[model samples]
Target: MATTPHAFETLKLTGLGRSFGGHAALAGLDLTIRAGEFIALLGPSGCGKSTALNCLAGLLPLTHGTITMDEKRIDTLSPEQRGFGMVFQNYALFPHMSVERNIAFGLQMRKVSRSETKRRVTEAIALVKLEAHAKKLPGQLSGGQQQRVAIARAIVLEPSLVLMDEPLSNLDAKLRLDMRTEIRRLHQSLGLTTIYVTHDQEEALSMADRLVVLREGRVQQVGTPEELHTAPVNWHVADFMGYRNLLDVTVTESGAEGVLVSNEDLHIRGTAVGGVTPGGAARLAIRPEDLRIASSEDTGDGLIVAEVAVVEYHGREFSVGATAKSGTTLYVRSELAPQPGDKVRLRVDPARALVFAADLDAAGEPVAQTALAGEAAT
Candidate 1:
């Protein structure tokens, strides 16, 4: 459906950093949140997603850097002065106030006239589809309903930006999924410029227009879900994006199609985002789903002999754990659920397997072949 256009310009966070007594929580985060864009700040715990959100909400002081909205500096503004709406993980609605009152509290605090406050509160409730529960207190509502109310309260102010910190994290799995759709729909309808901080990969991938993946207070990769999933720039990002099989391989040959890499026990040719030259050390990244497992009798050009370690039934397919002849453990998802200790052949599409520089700055280096392998038995 067509929706109203966004009113604001871009919001820029430049060299954003927050330090506490010589220890840095967020270090030099630079992002440009375009108007009407939904950006998810995604990372594991302590990756500075929340810290960045807090800084944007004016809840935390920036140790360094500036925040600009429409080319106007606003990092020094207080939370109220910034006039941004915030939704917390725990629904921070007033226990004593009804839904309408909770949504109208901001307007009341701003000393808005009663008629305008009522009109805005009505619009917000309708936007969240909480019109039926307008008179109910937060405690009387379900988790999802309460969260809708929280969202209504935030949007009632008609702020230029909206900040959400794991807003659906408190709900059950199904509720979280439902809210993901709801939030995305509301975002488009309102033409909101939102900054969502979420550690859940699925949530960020499904909702955000773009994702900023963070690790150790640094931006690892910023791209669309498909870009991050299919082409991780580094081993750490590959790992984070669920590239479970990471093998150390030395480049024995390089060509236009891809590079040929070899380990002590196996040699394979694969592609890399960056050029991998001969006589260079690199790590090969392969997703479990991209791996093919079959009987040794199956004819394949690049099959590697392996022994199945375990198999796990994942509803649609089986996740098989196996060790290559080179002793590199890997996980393979297949329809044929191979039993434990079964001798098999492992194969991968040359294009599906990605290679990264060995010295690439991974979040944490895997110590063994099984370091990132999945353990499951079908």
Candidate 2:
């Protein structure tokens, strides 16, 4: 596939919001997308990622705010008038139509010349490497093939912006991985500006140039994959970004170097974030891979002594579940296999640990003091 020309210089969303029956599904979404950039909307279900995609696609009307491309407002336009391509999770292909016909449908609807439509469709089919399957009906093709047809259909129109709403959700795990590569390749080869919606953190981190994490219809954080993974803005974002161990602790010391937090029987130092204050309650987040069994004679300042409850082999390493003396459960990945009932000293580098202000309830009390064991806080 050859690189297509760049589209608009910038697409801006100002206070972009959508509501359903007085309940806001997306609100105050302010973002500026540069042309030819791949952006992913990442979050768990009901986080308004899909709502934001739909609003961008013109499938849903905005409750408030505006969307503009290169300073030209487009929120008031119709879906067709917006001239953006959309690929849905279900593929949304016409079962009765052949792959070629499906790919040609949009061009046909636009009243493109017969010769031009056929040529564009041929190019699209080749671009997706589906020339052999072009004559096959949607039901006759595999899930991955059907998804390629959907992609071909969208790209044939040469739309400036492409919107995808969980497009790989229906595929099998292997197919999802394969399609991730395929979609990324096409986006790059086409020089497309894409906004993708997905709940999968790995998918977003792997494919997008930048990620926008949403929660409860609000933007939580927006940054590159490395930025979010290395330094999540809050505990919630940390939990979503694969920081599987989140423990409640009280900050004993805070400084430019970081913060030292402690719970009964456990004291750890971690990078302070979200304005953690000394003597205040905080949440400590550590990724499982970063937490490992400490070597003998390698006594560390933040050593956590735990009794291994289980150890499962993960081919490359062992996934260990342990209970600290403080009663907090911890998940760690280690090269050394520690059997159940074995006592181990776990350690995490201060750079790998993150501490944030504790989430507070409406009553100003710390919310859910228990740790999130091998799972994100939801």
Candidate 3:
């Protein structure tokens, strides 16, 4: 297996997978990441995003795969020999070492001269805007500072690719947003090939050049942020993208422009742009913001009327939930601030709606990983 030297070409994975006993962390997954690309590997916990990253980073041996860098194979190389820098979620800096020393450790391991190490350390500290804190130990720095130190150390080696595994998980919300901007700026200024592993939707959508949505050891969809948002391949992705009003409907024909929905009683017209099969079990997914509320309205060609059951208020928005006349539960986002027990009609735009087949186990179940996100302080 030969190694390639730069990130300006495609890094390919063919038949990549890992299996332990009867379970597979990743299975038969293939992807091609181009040089200088910034990709976010996004999925729920235990969904194989990390497993794929470990395989690509050479930290985990493949059960059956070939990794190619610029068309040359490099699957057998050790992690260090793969020439990729990594920033782990824990900011894995040496606790006793100063920020500058932590940044210089990789160069020191490679037997760089003391003078060169010092030069690189200086450059990295400047790049991360932590020159003033270079003398502090990991214990003495804030979580964001430590994360930046870890990032500086990773880039100080000038590796062709960088891997960040939930690097901002430890920071507070405000700090995470600040670091997000910083990382995006740094990636832009440097043009390094970066693979960011994250479960946070906003982080992935706001920062990534593209997204690779994974699920249960399979690649669900790969595309730009907008593409995934506007046209998800299935119900899981639509739900994940915040389309909470997913109601059952039926398509009468391929050429038909709308759908017939309800408990087989009501018929509603919606977009048929998603290549749905006629007379098939179809789900209409619409974003909460795409739905509107009214006190009175009649039967129409492009509207869904439901009775409000609950209304929750936040500072900037209100979330309303109701069961439509068709017995389908729906949630909508509104600024009007309706209250529970209020009788109101809901209207959702057809253009913003999505159609998908049901995948109950894969996409319908609520992920328990929300608890893990809350454990970031530990």
The top-ranked prediction according to TM-score is 2
lDDT of 1 by residue, 1-378 (tens): 124446567888999999878978889899988899999998877778899999889899899999998899999888999988899999898999999999999999999999999888888898888889999989999999999999988888887888999999999999998999999988888888889999888788889999999876789899988899888898767877888888888888888878888886467778976756688778899999998875546784567778899889999999999987777788999997878998887888899889887653365333443433321000
**How does each model score on lDDT?**
0.85, 0.90, 0.79
In model 2, which runs have C-alpha deviations exceeding 4 angstroms?
A: 369-378
lDDT of 1: 0.85
Q: lDDT for model 2, on a 0 to 1 scale? A: 0.90
lDDT per residue (tens digit) for residues 128-215 in model 3: 8997999999999999999999999988888888999999988999999999999988777777789999988889999999998887
lDDT of 2 by residue, 161-207 (tens): 99999999999999999999999999988899999999999999999
Candidate 2, pairs of clashing residues: none
lDDT of model 1 at position 69: 85
Clashes of 3: 1
**Lowest-scoring 10 consecutive residues by lDDT in candidate 2?**
369-378
Better of 2 and 3 by TM-score: 2
Q: Which candidate model has the greater lDDT, 1 or 2?
A: 2
Clashing pairs in 3: 7-35
Candidate 3 wrongly placed segments (more than 4 Å)? 1-8, 249-255, 264-266, 273-275, 295-303, 309-316, 323-329, 360-378
TM-scores of all models? 0.88, 0.95, 0.87
